[model samples]
Target: MAKQERAVRTRKALITAAAEVFSREGYRTASLTVISRLAGVSSGALHFHFPTKSALALAVEEAAADRLRVIVERCEKFEQPEGPIRLVVDASYQVVEQLAADPVLRAGFELGGHTVEMGSSGRVCDLWQRWVASVLEHAQGAGGLRSEVVPGHVAGLVVAVTAGLEELGRRDPRWLAHPTLTTFWRLVLPQVAPAGTSVPLQFAGS
Candidate 1:
């Protein structure tokens, strides 16, 4: 039990250190030596936990993807059809906010290596897209969205908009915190929400 606990702690430390280094130096430039120094571990110890830089990058991406999944899961609690769309917008903003707030996320972005792969990161994004698509499909079934717009297409649009917003936030951290985020949500919500459904401004209150 003690050995397992120690292993967990060491892994956490390595991940935290990696995040810091990756965010400051970027993935390609970040070296295991820097990660080891930041982690307060010997190079050998860091290598023991993560065999290669790519492995460490994968771990960071996995951690970021997990955080994203949690945000999407929370949206499932909303009872209204429009709730999902609202949740998507809110969640997207939250992701941006988190990127600024959490070094792990920031580092992952800084390190271009933190992308989703076919079996790992790709699966995560696919799952999230499916969740968003499910919500959009539900809205369409309830006559909340335009029948002409396919759920899959809407999902793609949402993902694209989210990527754009992320880039915007990266360029200007203030973008996520600005009132304009709510306005952006409002503009996009209409295109997905069921007809006659009112779009709420929950983030504006925040």
Candidate 2:
């Protein structure tokens, strides 16, 4: 048990160090040597946990996904049948706001963009798509969305929009600020929700 605990701690340290380096230098420029040094572990120790940079990157993506799933699950508990779409939109913005506040998330986003095709960071997009799909399915079941629109397709659109918005936010931290994010929520919720339903608007700023 002691050995397993130590191993878990070491792996966590390595991942944290790798996230920092990858965020700062980007995936292509980041080196395992630097990560190992920053993690206060030997290169052999680092390799024992993650054989390659791609593996480490994937681990980072998985960690981020796990954290996001937890948040989304928590938000789902507050879902209301009358305004499910609005609830989802508000929750989406809240998630983005939380990510913006987290250094690890910023790092993951940077790495994801830079190594989208080369590492596990690419899976992050798919994970986002799945999450959106699940939310859309719930909204559809609750009669919050139109029957004509397929949940998977709507989910894909939402994921695309979110990815675009995230990229924009990463490039310019001020892009999704107060009024702007509110405008986004207002615009998107109406398109997905049943007609005549007033979409609730809430900004993280307030």
Candidate 3:
């Protein structure tokens, strides 16, 4: 049991170290030597856990996907009462918060942009985009969206805007801050929500 627990810890450490290196240096340039050293593990341990850089990156992205799902699920559980638009707005804020605070998620999102280099087909952005689209479709059926609003269009816009914010936030943390998303939601919610619906126009806590 103790050996298994230590192995788990070693794997997590390697993933975290890989995420940090990948986040800073990007996938093509990130070095396994640096990742293993940063993880305080030997090269053999890293190899034992992840065989190759692509495998390590995949692990990082998978970890990020898990975190993203948790954030979405959490927002859905508490923010649904306010309506779909509210849920989206809150979820966006939470995502940005996680992006700001979690290197694994940030690395996953960044690595998603370099799928060609990694030869990986999955993208974290695509996952988020599909989720947004599905939720908006639900909103349309529930009469929460404006009569003329197309859920796909709204989802596209939302996903694009958030993707831009994520890219910009990579260089400037201010881009990921709460006020930035609040301002975006403020401008967009009015256009998306049905006429005269009393949707709350603030972040989850504020």
| Best-performing candidate as measured by lDDT | 3
Q: Considering TM-score, where higher is better, how would the candidates rank from best to worst?
A: 3, 1, 2
List residue ranges in candidate 2 displaced over 4 A.
81-83, 106-122, 147-150, 176-178
lDDT of 2 by residue, 1-206 (tens): 99999999999898888877876677888999999999999999999999989888878776766667776778778856465566567666766775566545545555566456664534656776777777778879989897786878877766666666666776687764656667666666666677887765666355
| All candidates in order of lDDT, best leading | 3, 2, 1
Candidate 3 or 2, higher lDDT: 3
Query: Which regions of candidate 3 deviate over 4 angstroms?
Result: 116-122, 204-206
**Candidate 3 lDDT (Cα, 0 to 1):** 0.84
Clashes of each: 6, 0, 0
Q: Model 1: per-residue lDDT, tens digit, 17-110? A: 8887776767778889988988888999888988988888778767766777777666556665455566666566666677667777655554
The estimated TM-scores of all candidates read 0.82, 0.80, 0.92
Worst 10 residues of 1 by lDDT: 116-125
For model 2, which pairs clash? none
lDDT of 3 by residue, 58-103 (tens): 8998898888899999988885575777788778878888888898
